[model samples]
Target: MKRSLEFFPVQLFAVIMGLSGLTIAFAKAWHFLNINYFEAIYKVLLLLDTILFFVVFMTYIFKWIKYPEAVKKEFNHPVKSSFAAAISISFLLISIAYYDYAPSVSIIFWWVGAPLHLFFTYKVMKFWIEHKFEVGHINPAWFIPIVGNVLIPVVGVDAQPEMVNIFFYAIGIFFWLVLFTIVIYRMIFHNPLGKRLLPTFFILIAPPAVGFISYFRITFGLIDTDSLFLYFIALFIFVLLLTMFRQFIKLQFFISWWAYTFPMAALTIATILMDSAYDTNLTYYGALFLLAVTTLLVAYVTYKTFIAINNHKICIPEEE
Candidate 1:
C-alpha cells in the first residue's frame, strides 16, 4: 500500500512536466515571444523540467532497487520500469547537453542514456506483445520518452552525426508505427466502448504526427523532399480535428483536449519545413496561419483545464 501510494506523485509529476514542456516547445518554435526574452523563458522551463526529470528518475530507481522482486512480481513485467528509468536519465543528460555545461558528464551520460532508452523501448514493446495489453489504455510507461523525443531536438543538442541518435530516432519511428497500427486496428475492428474510445484514438494519432514532424526536421538532408510528408500530415490533422469535433458534441471533453495541441503544432512546423523544400508562398502562409490558430486554441484549452483543475472538476474515470 505504501509503495502504491508513492507511485502516484511521481507519475503525476511526470505527466504535468510532459505537458508543460510540450507547451513551451510549441511557444518557442512558433516565435511567440521576442527572441531574447523567449530564449530566457525557454531555458528556465527546460531547467525546471530537467529537475523534475531527475526527481522522477531517482524515485523510480529507489522503488525498483528497493523492491526489485516485488516490482517484477506485481506487474509481471520488468520492461515498463526499465523503460521509465531510461527515459528519465536520458532527459537529464539531454538537458545538460543542451545547456552546454558539464561536457564530460554529459557525454558519459548521453552514451549511457541513449542506448538504454532504445533497449528499454524494445523491451516494452516485447512485453506488450507477450501480454497482449489492450490498445485503449494509455501505458503510463511511454509517457516520458514520447515527450522527450519531441522536445530534445528543440532543446538544441546537435544530435546529427551521432549513430546512437540516428538509431534512437529510427527505432522510435518504428515503435510509434507499431503502436499506432494496433490502436487503429482495435478501433475499427474491435470497437472498444465507453471513455477509453476517444482518448485512445487521440493518443494513437498523436505520435505519428509528432514522429513525422521530428523526422522531417532531423532527416531533411537524407530525404529528397518534405512536400510528400506534409500532404499526409495535413490529412491526419483534418482527421484529428473531425474526431475532436465529434467528441465535443458528445460532451466528453477532458484532458484529451490537450492531445490536439501537439499535433496541430507539428502540422504548423511541417508546413514550414515543406516550404523550405519547395519555396511556395502559399505553403508558407498556410503554415503560419495554422500555427497561430492552433496556439490560440491550445491557450484556450489550457485556461479551461486550469479552471477545471482548480475547481476540482477534472475527473478521469478510474481504470478497471
Candidate 2:
C-alpha cells in the first residue's frame, strides 16, 4: 500500500475548522467571566460555530464521497455510514438556514434537519448496540458531535420551537444514555490508560454534563417549582465532577484538559440559569477552575497537535 501527502489536506481542514469552533466556544466562556459581555460574545461564538460546523461537515462529506468503501469498512456496521451522511446533511441544512435571509428556506431547513439528525442518532445508537462495540470508552470523536448538535439549537441558533425542543431532548437523552452505558463499560472493562484515556474521559463526562444542562433549560419554564428535572441536572453535575476528579488524578490530561472548555461553559450557563432553583455556587466555582486549567492545557496540547498534524501523526494506530 502506498501513502501520500495528499491525505493531509482533508485532515488539516477538519482540524482547523474544529479548533476554530473550540476557540469561539472558549471565547464565549471567557467573556462570561466578566458577565457584562456574555451575550455579545455568545452571539459571536454561535455564528462562528455554525460556520465552523459547515466547513467540517463539508470536509467529511467530501471524504465520504471520495472513499466510500474505505470509510464504511472502518465501522463494523454499515448503517453507521448512512447515519453519518444523515448527520452531515442535517448540519449543512441547519447551517444554510442560519445564513439564509428568506423565511421559507430557513423554516424548511429547520424542519427537515431537526428530524433527520434525530433519526440519524437513533440509527447510530442501534448500530452501536447490535454490533456490540465497547460504548463506554468516552472518546472525543463521538462526544463532540453529540454535544454540538444539542447545543446548536440552544446556543448556536435561535431557541427551537417547544415541540422541536421536546423531540430533540427526548431523542438526545436516549442516545446519551446509550453513550453513557458504553463509557461506563469501557471504564470498568478497558481501564484505559495513557493518551487514550484523555479523549475517553471527556467522552464519558461531557455528554451527560451537557445533556443535563440542555434538559434543564428546555423544561425550566413548563415545569413546577419542585420538578424532577432539577434533580436530574444536579445528579448529572455531581457525576460529571466526580468523573473529572478521578480522570484528573489518573493524569489523562491532554484531551481531557482541553476538552473541558465546551462542557464547563455549558455547565456554567446552566448553573446561572438555575441559580434560583438550586444551590449552584459550587458548580459555578468548579466550572471556573476547570475552565482556567483547561485553557492552559489546551495551549500546550495545541502546540503538540500542530506538530503532530504536520508530521501526519494525528490518527492513532489501532492496537493489535
Candidate 3:
C-alpha cells in the first residue's frame, strides 16, 4: 500500500473520465430510444460512476498529501502533465451525467470543473511556450486539454449562458486543429509511440466527436454542415484507428490502455446524437453498434485493469 501510494499517478483519474463518458452515453441511449433496459443500466452506471469518482478522487488526494513531490513531478512532466486535465474533465463529465438527475449538483460540478479546466489549459499552454520539446514528446494525449474545452458546451449549454459555452467551444475547436496537425506530423515523421502509449491514438477521435455534440447543443440540436463536418472527421478517425486494431491487440496492459475508453465513448455519444437528428435506420443501428463497441471496450479494459491491479502491475514507478 505504501509503495502504491508513493507512486500513485494522476492518470488514474482517466478511469473516472471513461466511466463518466460511458454513463452519459447510455443515458443518451435511454433518452432517445426509451429502452427500459438502457434506462436501468443508465441509473446503475450513474451510481457506480459516482462511487468510482470519489474513490479515484480521494485516492489521488491522499497521494497528493503523502507524496506532494510525486504530484508536482507529474504536473511538470511534458507528456504526463496533459493527463492532469483528466481530473477536471472527470468533474465536467460527471457534471454532464448529473444534469438530468440533479441540476443543482450538476451546476456545482460545472462551476468547479469549468474554471479548473481553464486553469489547466492556461498552465499547460504556458508550459508549452516556456519549454523546448522534441517531436517525440508529442502524442494524441496533447489533445486532452482542448477536449475538455469542447466538453464545456455539452452541459454548459443548459447550466450557463450561450456565449459562455460558445467561448469555450471556439477555443476547443481552434486548438484541436492546431494540435491535431502537430501530433499527426510527429506520428508520420517521427518514431512510433511506445506500446504503452499507443492506445492514446484513439484520442485522435475525441475533439471532433465532442465538437459535434457541443455543436448540437449550441444549435438546439440542429444538424448543420459544420456539425456534419465535425461528425465525419470524428468518424473517419474512428475508422482509421479500427484498422490498427491488430497492433493494439498485441500490446501488453498498461494504465495508458484506459486511453481507449473515453474517446470511444465520445464517438459513441456523437453517433447517438446523430441518430437523434436523422431518425434513420442506418443512424439508429450505427449508434447502437458504436454503443455496444464502446461498452464492451470499456468493460474489457476495466477487467484488464483490475487484473493488473490485483497482480500489482499499476501505480508503481515507471521509466517515464
Q: In model 1, which regions exceed 4 Å deviation?
A: 1-113, 133-162, 217-223, 249-258, 276-281, 297-317
What lDDT is obtained when candidate 2 is compared to the true structure?
0.46
In the predicted model 3, the residue pairs found to clash are none
Residue 292's lDDT in candidate 3: 96
Model 3 scores a C-alpha lDDT of: 0.90
Those runs of model 2 whose alpha carbons end farther than 4 Å from true positions after fitting are 1-34, 37-54, 75-113, 129-161, 189-194, 220-261, 275-291, 315-320
Better of 1 and 2 by TM-score: 1
lDDT of each: 0.48, 0.46, 0.90
- Top-lDDT candidate index: 3
Question: What would the TM-score be for candidate 1 when compared with the true structure?
Answer: 0.63
lDDT of 3 by residue, 1-320 (tens): 32478787788888888899899999999998666699888889999999999998999999889889989999899899999999999999999998867889998999999999999999999999999998999999999976579999888987789999899999999999999999989988999998879999998889999999999999888899999999999999988888988999999999888899999999999998888878899989998999999899889999999998888877888876
Local accuracy of candidate 2 as per-residue lDDT tens digits, 1-320:
23332231222332332333344334434443444554454455456556755665676567667766545654333322322433433343344323323345445555656556656556555664576544433444454334334533443234366676666555556656665565556657775544543533443444554455455556553334433454345447546656667556555323233343434434444444344344367745655555555445445656766665566554443222
